[model samples]
Target: MTNQDSKVLRRNLLAGSAAVLAAPAIVGTALAQDKVTWKVQSHWPKASGSFNDSLVALAKELDTRTGGRFKLETFGAGEIAKDREIYNIVRRGVVPMGTISPAYILGEAQAMGLFYGVPGTLRETWEMLQLTKNLGIEKLVNDELAPKGVVMKAEKAYPTEVVLRRKIASAADLGSLKIRSAGTMLEYLAAAGASPQQIAGPEIYQAISTGVVDGAHWGAAIGALSMKFWEVARFHMKPALGITNDAWIMNKAALDKLPADLKLQFLSLLEERYFLRSVEYLQQEAIALNTGKAKMNVEVVRWPDDVLKKFAEASTGILKKEEAKGEISAKGTKALIKLMTDLGYV
Candidate 1:
């Protein structure tokens, strides 16, 4: 009875254990082989600026990191949905992800306007970065956006400047100008006596050329140059309107469905690229400014101190108006004001 039966029993147990251990590896391999391609719709065109360029680079990096198991196809503004519709498109899963300016969706959530770097608020890139990273603004923003079925994976910011076809040196000059802008800045500009219109990216060039609008607020120096804004507008206003920040968001359901390891890899890669691209943009802005002035012959105009003061006052008034509309807006605006005040920005 004894030795032969005992040896056979031991061999059978070991074989079963080996098969159990090997099963998971086989399953993992199969899962990895099942590829996924997500479409990312962006509010910026492919050649618009560094932000869009970074997005393109990220898509390629995603393919490399996942060994081509995961891929991202990015579409520029107006290709899938207009800039203002990106948020809803991602929410409805028409696309898995999008690059959106929270300000564009102010109608959906009044608080979102506060998240896009309140006009006349933090002008420095470092300050804006700190607000999103260290001041908890990112959490407040995500808290509001998540309920709408989108999750912000990363934040991208760039310096902003106003481009004008006609010369404007002071607040008084604004009264005669009609400008195109977005977010709360429109309110601020209107308060300063300019007629503000919300124009989509593709229309700005024609708007400036055909005399539909005298000027427009756009991304930093690099952004303007990339879009060839100088061709239509000769003046670039200095002391940027604000450091504009937008969220790179994903469909909550689609993101949650990713395998745990792939999810981690995706987020990690996005974060690293976001940081590197932000730094690159800062450098590019400087180069663009110099190039715009020297090579492109674009005029740089600085608003008078009194005029700038009025803009700050207008921004504050608009912020208070928005804060009064809803609890979320109130909380978000209060937090940002407190942060800026504490940091000596106000």
Candidate 2:
């Protein structure tokens, strides 16, 4: 791939997607000849490279596959709505669809965290995918979201890595340090005896630089590299927390209006590309680690087995509380425990 094309592939970690299409219909049935274009708002800047290109590619696929009867226009984060505002805009149909992290909507239902990234779980992308499927997470979250006028679909899954200015060699390394974090991971970090704070994305670089926070669990290598986290903190924690999952959040009513054949085509593309997107993030993450080390003098820390064991223990405590959150969370927790148990981590 060309350098520019490769850069596009290097920068996505928490990215996700879903699309919508509609045209005038005869008695509620979409007409195959009708042309329609819907707008998609990204959760990151155009500099996000592959995260942005992935959606553009999806849009192109939709256009080519449907012979131009369907099209989507893409916009970067904040062009259509602020990151936190994407769910509302997409649901209200102010924009047909937008990229979002389920992390932002834990209030909609705590079970949404199952999709976001439940700490103490396996870090591998495929293992997490299996957890999502086994728990019927898609059905659970969408069941809540659909009635609210939104439908969520994940296009890719990538790890949320951590960076710190200090050495992290064991469980003691986790003690009393303030870290910027969000979602359920906060609870896990707290359980590990670390202080987790909520800081705006734009402020994180400065927060670390000024000792406002010791570290942050943002995106993986490529994403943190994009944010220049290495300038302030060189240790990039390895064995990422886990691949965070969000979605191409779409207006449910608009998507429901899609023709059956066209709808099938959309789903076919989503299914076929699920694993591909995860692998892309994984490959790009590896490249990013090399780039950061060679060009930016970044360091990688592989959390030891004992520290990881303490984490698993702490994760179970938080998992029980997660189970108490609601019905779906309870079921999802059981699935997490069952899987983790089989893997000998719980």
Q: In model 2, how many backbone clashes occur?
A: 3
- Give Cα distance to truth, residue 21, candidate 1, Å: 3.1
> How many pairs collide in each candidate, listed in order?
0, 3
In terms of lDDT, which candidate is strongest? Answer: 1
Question: Model 1 clash pairs?
Answer: none
Please list the residue runs of candidate 2 whose C-alpha ends up more than 4 Å from where it truly belongs after superposition.
1-30, 168-176, 206-211, 304-310
What is candidate 2's lDDT per residue for 10-109, written digit by digit as tens?
6542132211222233434545666778898877666554455478878888899989888889887678775678888888889888877787788886
Evaluated at residue 323, the lDDT of candidate 1 is: 82
Candidate 1: minimum summed lDDT over ten consecutive residues — where? Answer: 106-115
| Per-candidate TM-score against the hidden true structure | 0.91, 0.82
lDDT of 1 by residue, 1-346 (tens): 6999999999999999999999999999887777889998888876688445677888888889889988998888889997878888899999999888777877765566666777888767777777676766667767877788888744567776888887776778888888889888787788777889999987887898899999887787876788888888879887887776767879999998998778888988876765677678889888888898898889888876766888888877877886897887787777778878987976
Question: In order, what lDDT does every prediction score?
Answer: 0.80, 0.76
lDDT of 1: 0.80
